[model samples]
Target: MSTTTLTPKITMAQAINTALRDAMTADDRVVVFGEDVGPLGGVFRVTDGLTASFGEDRCFDTPLAESGIVGMAIGMAMNGMRPVIEMQFDAFAFPAFEQIVSHVAKMANRTRGKVRLPMVIRVPYAGGVGGVEHHCDSSEAYYAHTPGLLVVTPATNADAYGLLRAAIDSPDPVIFLEPKKQYFSKEEVDVTAPVPPIGRAVVRREGRDATLITYGPSVPVALAAAEQAAAEGRDVGVVDVRSIVPFDDETVCAAVRATGRAVVVAEAPGFASVASEIAARVTERCFHHLEAPVRRVTGFDIPFPAPKLERHQLPGVDRILDAVDDLQWEES
Candidate 1:
């Protein structure tokens, strides 16, 4: 069915909440549970009003145990229920790492197709909220590394609604990482509109000089840099890779090849990150089309810094433009 409904402007968090309410209303088997998800509506209030609307069975709270939350969700999925479990914070999810990596991720394959774990694990991630240690880690690479998980992160309000809906309905387990930084960022979104497929990347802007490949929270930064580049007479394109696990290489490589230069950006540290994988793939596929080596604008290789120090650690407009500036000096 077409998910086409015109709606007023809204924030990413609001779009997500709409998706959850819709999912619960559409399917009785669908359920949501996490710490404070019922009463507090989650730390960000993304699940706010769900309990009042869907009642305790559909929208409820779990113990403060991450592992138990995931493990129980896995069991529920196997028993013919679709469970959407939330991990309150990014770092807080690590406590359930064993269940995720060992069980939830491999359940389908482990049962040799006899079982399907249709579950969604939601995590609020990344810095910019002035959050403490466990609150702002970009742990996407860890889930992307797992074999059986479908990892997705949405940058805009529309994608947030569409992708969250898609994730809840997916036959496999999904790690839906919500960029905390972009939660309050607003846009006009139609919750009923047809959403793009889960893994396809979208080119937010077009250009001829260079392409800025980014996803999640860093998408806005890349787009801002592109605008700045345009003012300086440089045509810089921007691609939002909405999904991390499937990693849209075709769209990204095509954009880079057309521009002949590319910069991959991510808030995660540079060492072995999603940005690194993007750089490698673009280089391999668009090797002959490239005029310069692929560059990455990412967080530092150290731990997530203190709140006040994040501005310097995270990639910004200047950092992205600097990478683009480097591309100009390279020979064709």
Candidate 2:
């Protein structure tokens, strides 16, 4: 069955709310709970109306303890219930790191595949809204480094709805990172269509000059930069890597090979990050077809800065275009 129905144009937050509603209706065992998720409707109101519609039993609020919330979700999943828990903010989820890595991530393996840790950890990540400290951290690389977690970030309203439903239905734990910057962005979507499953990359724009690979908040930056490059007589492509962990290597490699040049973009720092992994993989897969070395446009290797300095810290469209310009397209 499809995860969506005919619905009016909505924002990413509303689309996600719709997915939560749909998931709970499809599966009675699906439950949603977290700090402020019940009556307050989550920090971004993504869980708004869930409690009123599904009742307290299905949608409720937990204490301010992140570890406890995740630990409880693990127990619930082990006992056969599907729990969807939310971390109020990106850096706020740090308190639950221990439970996530030690228990939630290892439950299925410890149970020898006999039990499935069917849970979804929703985190509102990335910057652009000028949030305070600890509110806009791009910690996706940390979770992606964890062995048992499936990390995914959606760039469009459709994936925001579809992928959340897919994550809730998965048999294992999933780290669903929503780009907070895109929460209010609106788009027309056909709710009746089934979106691609997790681990697939979608090419938002097609071009042969070069490929601009990005995800989450960086997707829009990459697309805009591609457009700017087009006006400059460079036909650049944009690839949104919806899933980070089980990355769509086939699609990424194909696009890079076709273009002969690539630039990866992400909001995370430039250390051992998702962008680093992608650049490395593209270099390995498309070495023969490359016109220049793969470039990465990412955040600085320092802590997330304050609101005023965020523009300088985060990678913007001009920065992405700078990386594209750095690509030595003249090579044979």
Candidate 3:
């Protein structure tokens, strides 16, 4: 006789909530605080019930000042606490940029390794849920560009739980970008399951003709485009670049080299963006293997537009397919 273990099907938001609860339960040093995070349970309720489970001292709300919230987290981290603070929204995090860059990022290095800041700054980012101006923005590039910080984002529900747990465990500070658009997306996940650590990338689909490399919210879009390309007789692969800071060059270059054609897809603008960096890296490492120049399917170089005009700025399935078509395929 054999027994079967079952995993619970959960949304990305719930997975995040579970991660927080488990982390707090395991470590008394772990705390959760942000705007509307306590009694209100956050704007998306990702922090819902955390306050109820941990009580006010462990899970409480803060004022609307983003800088103060981050500053306080930094102070707590320096004093040996693992803080997981939320920024409320992607754009709202700008006000705390100084604290992140000057203090949180540079603390350990500035102390010559005498200090380690175990902290996670959570930012709900990217467009898709018809959010207004300050709510939807892809700000990963800024954190990725900064040194001494581990920048990571999750594309699926399991990753949402796993990555958050890993971030909470890190001794170095982390910029945890949660794709708000995928918050409600569901998947069967075991909260106790181990996932790839930070600084690794995973290939979501495998193929030989071409590769679509993306992360966060664009992972689903790339997968959809790969499916459509399959129907059209083109075998395209998809790579989810889960970590932006410590990019997995081995996995990404391998995928592009295998196909000899590639397109970098992202929700941020193409200019001087993470997409641009990946394309350049592929060219630098896999230049001889390339059958064509690497293409990019990314958002326009403008502020995130209103809900009505967002689709025009975001990379979509049709746009990704068009980019794959431009990869200089031989005429049959």
**Model 3 lDDT, residue 286, Cα:** 98
In the predicted model 2, the residue pairs found to clash are 4-191, 5-191
1-332 in candidate 1: lDDT tens per residue?
23356577788889999999899989999999999999789989999999999899988998899999999999999999999999999999999999999999999998998898999999999988999776789999999989999999999999999999999989999999999988898888887677668889999999999999999999999999999999999999999999987888889888988988999999999999888888998988999998888999999998999698989999999999998999856465
In angstroms, the error of model 2 at 191 is: 1.7
TM-score, every prediction:
0.97, 0.97, 0.97
Model 1 pairs in collision? 3-192, 3-193, 4-192, 5-192
Q: Give the deviation of candidate 1 from the true structure as CA RMSD.
A: 2.0
- List, residue by residue over 23-130, the lDDT tens digit for candidate 2: 999999999999999998998999999999999999999878999999999999988899999999999999999999998778788889987799999999999999
Tens digits of per-residue lDDT for model 3 on 1-332?
11133256778889899999999999999999989999888898999999988999999998889999999998998888999999999999999999999988899999999988999999999999999878899998889888889999999888998999999999999999999999888887766576569999999999999999999999999999999999999999999999998999999999999999999999998899999999999999999999899999999999899699999999999999999999888742
Number of the candidate with higher lDDT, 1 or 3: 3
Off by over 4 Å in 1: 1-5, 328-332
